[model samples]
Target: MSGHSKWHNIQAKKGKVDAKRGKIFTKIGKEIVVAVKNGGPSEDTNAKLRDVVAKAKAANMPNDNIQRAIKKAAGELNSVNYETIVYEGYGPEGTAVIVECLTDNKNRTAGNVRYAFSKQGGNMGSTGCVGFMFQSKGEIVIEKTDSTDEDELMMLALDTGAEDFAAEEEVFVVTTAPEDFGKVREALSESGIEFLEAGVKMIPDTYTEIDEETAVKFQKMLDVLEDDEDVQEVYHNAEFPEGWEG
Candidate 1:
């Protein structure tokens, strides 16, 4: 994969979400509830739930909020049904885009997503239209600190089943198979290495370089989709011009 990993984009948004703490928590809470409904509330027995808990912790979600979400999910007679849906589209400059959403009302979510695409000079496409342009993988980000040992980190990642490793400008990005993500993360944790972000993501196989003008429009389209309550993630193959600050 060229350019930055999806983890980088998500990390950039972390700061923005920090200011809107409630919004972040709400999104995580919904995921937790969905995990509970899919496979009981016990993190020990449910790998998905465990991953969600880890994600919540990484986001700095309060312990109270986590427990409350689990407790409410455990007690619900008829849980809120959130179906996972993937919407594919083309962004400005023919950038392949994918939007992952967890929505109870597919019509509403689809309408909002389609509107965002149309309003931003893009067009929504049929399912699987752009999905083939990306591959699913586990991505982990670790900030470069004074104590970080580049060689040691690389060794740890390789020994722990990481498939690829890259040193970015501000952080080390580790890639692994989706199934190995938890094991790799656990090993890193035991090695006393803290991660800035870790999750499964759709990584583009190839990049489509976009000019400043197209990048601006593409970013606006992303913002519109991200601002929606149901959109969980948005992936794209856009590689903005070098030194472009997004």
Candidate 2:
């Protein structure tokens, strides 16, 4: 943990993983199903479902697939029920990791996740072991080109009781109190600023740093977590050096 890069350049060059579309679709569908089952099918009434729909649209999921997911989630069609779970662990160089997932097979996911950590030079820790190292908050990313100025956004978000705000390289990161997330998101929308992404995420209290070699290994661990259809997000308390910008 000599240095840290909280923001990794995730835009590295690579061929399209379009072949993973089916895997992505299956993961997204499970998410929609769980969201609908927990909160109901109507997007207007179910905030969770609304967010899931937004995510599906962002990912370019087919309308038919979306409709079918909602149907299955509402039990209008036969499908296995899923539950939301979070896994906390330590990665290479003691980087804290939090993984969010939706799965019907808890045991299977736990085994898979643990195996990935072990093979990747990390170890899975007890639940809440690393959770305390992060805070759960709603995050929305808006483009820098938007006419919305930081001062204007700060005032508006503060008026709505937002927790924190930061203007990053290409986007603004707006953090909101968990309960006021939807309100903040809507207010931003009404202001005509387009958001790139919105969701609840775990932001680390502090970031640990590893050498370039270890950082690449940690990145591989992240790949393993994200590849799981059951896994939704993998939050780490590791940061890369700005110089290590990929």
Candidate 1 C-alpha lDDT tens digits along 154-227: 99999989988888878899899999998898788778887767778899888888888987888788878878
Candidate closest to the true structure, highest TM-score: 1
How many residue pairs of model 2 clash at the backbone? 3
lDDT string, candidate 2, 73-184, tens digits: 7774345767788888888988898889888899999998998798879999998898988887877666677566778877777687677777666666778767788888
lDDT values of the candidates?
0.83, 0.74
**lDDT measured at residue 59 in model 1 versus the true structure, 0 to 100:** 76
Per-model TM-score versus the true fold: 0.92, 0.85
Tell me the number of clashing residue pairs for each predicted model: 0, 3
- Which one wins on lDDT? 1
Lowest summed lDDT across 10 adjacent residues in model 1 is found at 1-10
The runs of at least 3 residues in candidate 1 whose Cα sits more than 4 Å from the true structure, single-residue gaps closed, are: 1-15
